[model samples]
Target: MCTFRMASNSNQMPRLDLHKDSKKLSRAQLDYMRIIEQQNLERVRRLAKQRSNNIMVGCLLGFGVLGIYGYSIYSVKQEKFLDELD
Candidate 1:
């Protein structure tokens, strides 16, 4: 178990003065933000693709295992019936 304590000032958070004559962002800032956002989006897409691929691989493996098990059962039954006829 874990416990957390809140500070007294946490209730009354300080407000940011956005219009306090802040410095303007140069073209470099925009370019940097664009690149960061692009990379983040790419990462998300890659993760989604990997998840789908993993799911597909798992399904294929499950079917393969089931097929092998079913074939073994069928072959055993067939051999038993043939032996009985003999």
Candidate 2:
């Protein structure tokens, strides 16, 4: 029960024991480990891509808003509205 877990990130890998005589995994267990590792890798890759996209979008929106504010001030200055007050 991870209280701070992210909803989209969930992964579980089962524990397996090696063969006592061989000191290695059986053929099926090895295959299972490979498959699980591949799945986990794919999940990691997908999550990384998603995170990069989110960061890019957030940065673009943040910078765009800042640019908008800067332009607003520049346009207002061009109007000389404040000149009337002074």
Q: Work out the TM-score per prediction.
A: 0.63, 0.62
**Candidate 1 lDDT tens digits, 36-59:** 999999999999999999999999
Please provide, for model 2 over 1-86, each residue's C-alpha lDDT reduced to its tens digit, 9 standing for 90 to 100: 55685455347554455544335657786788789999999999999999999999999999999999999999887996778898
Question: Model 2, 5: alpha-carbon shift in Å?
Answer: 22
Local accuracy by lDDT, each model: 0.82, 0.83
What value does the lDDT take at residue 56 in candidate 2?
100
Task: Work out candidate 2's RMSD over C-alphas.
Answer: 7.7
Q: Least lDDT summed over 10 consecutive residues: which range in candidate 2?
A: 13-22
Question: How many residue pairs collide in each prediction?
Answer: 0, 0
| Model 2 lDDT, full chain set | 0.83
- Quote the positional error of residue 40 for candidate 2 in Å: 0.5
